[model samples]
Target: MNAPEFKKLPGVLAFQRGLVITDALFFNVLKDSQTPVMVVRHGIRGTQNVNKDGDAEKSTAANAKRQEVSNIQTTDTAKLEEEAQALAVRFGLRFLDLKDVLFACAPASTDANDLVRNYRDSVTGFIERAKTSPGLDEVAQRFARNIANGRWLWRNRTIARQVEVHVSVNGTPLASFDALATPLNHFDNITDAERQVAAYIADGLRGDDDAGLDIEARLDFGVRGALEVFPSQNYVEDKPRGFARPLYCLGSPERAGSRNGIEFESTRTMGHAALRDQKIGNALRTIDTWYPSYAEHGRPLPVEPNGASLEAQEFFRDRKTSAFEFARRLNTLDPASPEGMFMIASLIRGGVFSGGKE
Candidate 1:
């Protein structure tokens, strides 16, 4: 029989995210009670901008006429209450089976469908090999390190004097980590607790169990004063004057117009300050040390198809290192290699990767 002819990828190909994360809810811990931290609107006075260019007399006059203006700012701020010692953030994580990674794949034509059918076994073999590979295990280890290090806390982690992370599998308590003591910049060294967590995560990825992991992280500022904590900020296209920043919050529909209610993304709410699931997932998957510039940059970026870093304003990967290129050569790559691991990790990260023709 003639070999199957395949020159291009399927027109519609996508993978479901393997590492599923839930939105993290924030709570203000006060003595024996835990309450949801609500977003509040603050009204403050600020001086207006004064033109200081051109004529000196005009500049002086403009400065003199500049008046104090009332500015209303709406944001979500979490703090340890006067009687509280810590702020708690709770979220859940689910690791999907890599064996069932593909979410969608629609071939453009009958020939293409035949080609994919012929190539399916090769792809399956690669995935099966990856399951037992050390490279994949390393990826899982990095993910666990992020959890143990409290990287998901984002800005809140910076202000925390002490952080404790509690993890559980299903409902059973597994391990706790001293998040403050764990380094965030590198994953070269991992404590025994981090390794334990990584084993569970690796098992989950390999489809050893279906039950997910639950996590709760507490940040202690070591002070009774209200120290501001950061929550995920919402993106508003048409922000009103003085309302440039908006924080994310969750509330019930029944509380929409109630006296204790506030806007979902704006206004003072009886809701809770929380981080988005996307943000949480991004933190968990910041394990792309395989990127070319990672050695020079000294930081791991989130696994992306292009090794893109929005903050750095650069794409670290060229065509050779891109996910598309890796996918193209998946059948030939050694599943235990770093490049192969990164390709599989990208699939776990999940996205539309249809390369229509050529």
Candidate 2:
């Protein structure tokens, strides 16, 4: 697997997954999955007046935006700033921070509170739209980054040999460690045949003799489903740079809100199918090594006393399990009773079910 020729190549191949449902305001352009539009919210919404310069005095536009941005009453500007950033990150959106543009868009009044609040509310509403909208809107941004960076990486590689990997995601892009990016519930409701195919996917990833097939891939998708054990939610980070979750989902749009990270590792890849297959191995092992270490930084497991219960077993299994094995165990858990089915469904929801149901 250590072929120096294939160590690193150039250029990223990204198969973009667009939003299933566009945001409320941008619905006109975003409704059709095939049709994508760069949603331009109130022009001032993204325009930012601040740069690294400290000496640029405000022109009428700058002064108006400054006045407007400053007028928004908030006890904690830091918190407000963080909110603005989080919204930006969650949606993988670019916040132009055009306080100046906003001023240009409207009349400059000494009282900017009402106008600022209106902008804030607009941003807040966009955040809400991101939480539930089917993915696609945000992944476009990721693809943009990948395309731009991959080209650069390709041009600057150490090897004369070049490689490229094309990937399409099926879930929301939350910061994730593994390829289990499909929503758990989608897997949960599937027929046994689906599980088997999924299991095959897992097996294809970690299978013996499956080595040397460089450029190969196994999708470790994220899941979306009801959380049975903790019945709780995630503690999100809100800032301009990073979010507690992944910024984009790769595959299907319906699975957007799961915010579960899943997609190709990078844009650069090799044309060699064998090389690509082997690369999938590398990606899988990397994910395997990091999932447990990174998944529970500050998060706590919800209290579930019965270790054998669906919630309890899954909590432990998912935490310590491999993507392939997790799928293998699906439906094997006695499917005779309702609890078994629920458990199986939960496993599917957990992105672990990959076996064909008999």
Candidate 3:
């Protein structure tokens, strides 16, 4: 019998344990793919208290200090880890210990977004170190180039080398199929104007349609004229009835170059369909979660009618997926998603404060 194809995806999309991702957007991916959620957690790192750098044997006191610095309740951490492991086992996904992939080359930093920063740095570092391995050097080189050009700086890109497909029915795991996964840049070669157009659409923004044209003829002409070259790929064009494909279809690189990559197209397409089915409210909900400050305004930025304090509102907002997921999906094309507007507001605010105090 032929071995099952594994998914080598760019990244695993896990539900942040405490955050409430919109039911519409969150369930959309789940409803479509029907894949088991792969929970992730990082390992302990040493600070002044411990020497986790090398294989040096530290004193008992150091170990105690490291545990103390973890700031995590052992009972809670162990329970969470146990639950995640159990889920993997129940779903029949090989228990993948990703500590090596996460921290093998992480740099110590004091940034507020340290986990994300370290993850990016570690992935790049791992790619560099794994250059001698087959089929990795080229990927590393391309990734480095993309980063230098800020291709993924605004978006969430994934990197998965090992993946398994488990068939589930009614949310119950049934059968497991092995697969491989990897990173792909679907829109790296698109012109800037085209990207901008996709960005606008993905942000749930609409413009006056002209006859059969989606955006105004003048705006469309301006964008096309600036491009100098038109994309001939059928996938790049709008579908019949004048709607564009969801970002997932156009953003994934066509050439994953692996046997599993071939399977990815179908899976990705299904995911796109799921996302496309989501209502615009999903995106609005995410935006609302991210920028509660705008709540003072109405309609465009809805705040609860309750007379909640600013700090209370913020605390509640932070519990939503907007806190982390937006930063991950910031640059990706999701024509129906709201990250574009949120990111734009953030950028504009940053610029406004660049020359002065907030």
Segments of candidate 1 deviating more than 4 angstroms: 1-7, 47-76, 109-113, 253-267
TM-score for candidate 2, please give it: 0.17
Candidate 1 lDDT, 224-250, residue by residue in tens: 766677788889875665554667777
Off by over 4 Å in 2: 1-33, 39-190, 208-358
Candidate 1: 10-residue stretch with minimal lDDT: 252-261
- Residue-by-residue lDDT tens digits, candidate 2, 98-193: 111111122133323343334334323332332232221222222222221222121112121322222222332222211122221111233332
* Model 3 C-alpha lDDT per residue in residues 1-358, reported as the tens digit of each score: 1112111111321211111112111110221233222211123333344455655455433234334453321110111111121111111111111112222222223322344443344333332333233222222222222212222111111122223333333344333322222122221343333333333222221122111101100001111111111111124443333122223211223343354654533221112111121222212122232245444543222212121234344333342334233333322323123343333322211211101111
Which RMSD values do the candidates have, in order?
A: 5.3, 27.5, 27.5
In order, the Cα lDDT scores of the candidates are: 0.77, 0.22, 0.24
Every model's TM-score? 0.86, 0.17, 0.19
TM-score leaderboard ranking: 1, 3, 2
Q: Give the candidate number with the greatest TM-score.
A: 1
> Model 2 residue 204 lDDT?
24
Greater-TM-score candidate between 1 and 3: 1
